[model samples]
Target chain A: MKFGVVTFPGSNGDYDSYAAVRFAMKEKVEFLWHKSEDLQGCDAVILPGGFAHGDYLRAGAIARFSPIMKHVIKFAKSGGIVIGFCNGFQVLTESGLLPGALLRNNHLRFNSKFIYIRVERTDTPFTGVCRKGEVLKIPIAHGEGNYYNFESDVRKLEDNGQVLFRYADASGNASAAANPNGSINNIAGIVSAEGNVLGMMPHPERAVEDIIGSSDGLKVFESVLNYCISPKPVGRL
Target chain B: MTTTAKTKKVIVYVRLKDGVLDPQGVTIQKALGQMGYPDFVSVRSGKFFELEIDAGASDIDRQINEVCSKLLANPVIERFSVEKI
Candidate 1:
């Protein structure tokens, strides 16, 4: 399956995501320009990281209105596969493709480090290859990764099993200390209600190679590829 | 009758919804406490935007409302108020 990595004007992680799919995953990949309103017939779309439109007003407020985003939103609503990482996650939430909002880190500082996140649910296409509760080491770099939502929406997300990843310790305990950005319930990643769209703060694409430290992130990419190869009805979450 | 276009200003205020955590505001409150201003009641941070529009723009209120809801504030955690200034 071909992967489309979107490149907004200020997107710095576009190349990284492209390399991960083209070289690491050995898959056909193309760069989708933000101003273009086309998906380029890709099976999956990746809204890679970086400060789009200079992150003015909010991290993703401007980029969410990009021309390509209109198509991205339509594509996602039609049950297409979309994964957003870092600033990409912010855009997804701002675009209403994902639930909740990302606020400034509780400590009001930009955090950059390798953190462990446990797969909360393996039913989604993004985590299909991982065992339930398995811990994956990934890097998170952001200033506003703190996730927030209305109390009722949080309950709905939990009930629907949409919460997919939570920051955790090596032992897989999602303790308060392990919560990197103080996301409610340590939520590091989540899938849309339909389970076709995923938004996560951590850069799984940055962790695909062992030489870079850990290859735990490759599992996520592989799971998506596997799901694409054999299309099946996804469990609503 | 001939009408000339005039410039009008609209002010928009955006704030996080109640119960939503405001880390920047919290940090400011903490700093205030450290500065020996313990009596400070509270602090909540917010943002605003000033827009200039044509005075004769049709459905000006509706246009401002749409902009506020669609871009100025994120409905999930923020609320926005618009006023013709």
Candidate 2:
């Protein structure tokens, strides 16, 4: 399926996302500028990581008002596929397409390193190719990766199986030590209530090739392709 | 007769909700303790914005409130107060 990677001002990871889709996944992909209101008839969209609009006011706050986002929001609400990584994740939360918010790391330091995350659920389109409880080594680079939400909302996300990935050890233990950013419940990634939009702090695009580090992230893209090609009734499994 | 709209300056103060965690505020509090200000038991960091709006516009208060809630602050984890000077 064709993918549209949006490039907002100061978006540094757009190229990485585009290359991952075009070269690694061997899928048709195009760059959607922030000002462009068109989706270009793409099957899926990716909001790559970066300090959009210089992260003014707040991360993703300004970017959410961009012209392209109006269409993206409508596309997502209509059951279209949209995946956001890092700052893109922040954008998703700010746009109200996803629940919860990303906050400053409890340590007040920027973290950039490889970390392990366990697949909490594989029923969603984003993780269909991942095995239940499978741990993937992925790198996270962000200062405001700490995720926060109301206690009641978090419970709803958990009850509905919206929590898709969590910081974990190699053995698939979702322990506090494994959580690099102090996200509530070690949540590294989560899907929307409808399971069409995914917001994750980890940079899976950077891990698509083994030369960089691990190829486990490819499974995420593969999962999307699998679901789009022949979508099954996606519900809590 | 054409009339000019009056310009009013409004201030918006934004703070994290009472129970939400504020890591920057915690770090500042730690530094304050180290610097011998033990009496400063708490530090909750926040930000403010100054806006100039058309005072003659209809429902000026409502407009300011809308901007504060929709842009200046995220209602999920923050609360905001508006002051018209």
Candidate 3:
């Protein structure tokens, strides 16, 4: 399947995402400029990590208003596959495509390191290839990855199984110590209620090559491919 | 008679929701205590934006409110107040 990686003005991870899909997954991919509204008929779209608009006002706040986001938002509502990582995830939350907000890190420091995240669910398109409770070692780099939402909304997210991943230890235990940014309930990633959109803090694109560190991130792309070939009926199209 | 639109200055204050944790604020409060200001008790950090709007614009209040909610502050974790001053 073809994938589209969006490149905002300050996007530094766009090339990484493009390389991951083009080389690692052997899939067709293109860079979609933030000023362009066309998606180029891509089956899936990836909002790669970076300090878009210099993370002004707030992380991902200005990037959410990019011209291309209008089409991306529309595509997601139509059940298109969209995955956002790092600053991309922040944009998703800011755009209201996903619930909650990402705040400054609890420690008031920029964190950049490999962290373990347990796959909480495998039913969604983004995690179809992942085993439930499987822990993937991925790199997270951001100063504002602390996720937060109203207690009631968080409870609803949990009840709906919208939470797809959580910060976890090597043994897959979702504990406070494993929490990288003090996200509520150690939430590392989550999918929309419709299950077509996903937002995560970790940099899966940066983990696709074993030479760099680990190849576990390849599963995320593979899972999207698997879903495209045989999409299961979702609640809403 | 033709009248030109006048620019009106407005300020918007954005703060983290009451129940939301503010790590920066906490860190500042800690630093204050270490700096010999023990009676400070607590601190909350926030930001404000000054906007220049056209006074003759229709539905000025609604527009300002919309911008404040949609861009100035994230409603999920932030609260915003607008002032005409």
Best model number under TM-score: 2
Clashing pairs in 2: none
Which parts of model 2 are misplaced by more than 4 Å?
B1-5
* lDDT of each residue in A89-175, candidate 3, tens digit only: 999999999999999988989999999999988878888888999999999999999989999999999999999899999999999
- Cα lDDT tens digits, model 1, A1-237, are 999999998998999899888899999999999999789999999999999999998989999989999999999999899999999999999999998999999988899999999998887789889999899999999999998888899899999999999999999999999998889999999999999999999999999899998889899999999999997677766
Please report the interface RMSD of model 2 to 1 decimal. Answer: 0.6
Give the whole-model CA lDDT for all candidates, comma-separated.
Answer: 0.91, 0.93, 0.91
**lDDT for each residue of candidate 2 in A1-237, tens digit (9 for 90 to 100):** 899999999999999999999999999999999999799999999999989999999999999999999999999999999999999999999999999999998888999999999998888898888889999999999999999999999999999989999999989999999999899999999999889999999999999999999988899999999999999767753
For residue A152, what is the lDDT in candidate 3?
94
Candidate 3 Cα misplacement greater than 4 A, ranges: A234-237, B1-5
Can you give the lDDT of residue B77 in candidate 1? Answer: 84
Give the residue spans of candidate 1 off by over 4 A: B1-5
Q: What is the DockQ of the complex in model 3?
A: 0.82
The deviation in Å at residue A45 for candidate 3 is 0.6
The candidate that achieves the highest lDDT relative to the unseen native structure: 2
- TM-scores for all candidates: the values are 0.96, 0.97, 0.96
Model 2 reaches what TM-score against the true structure?
Answer: 0.97
Docking class of 3: high
Q: Which digits, one per residue and each the tens of the lDDT, describe model 1 over residues B1-85? A: 2323587888899998988888888888888999999887678999988888889789988999999998888888889988776
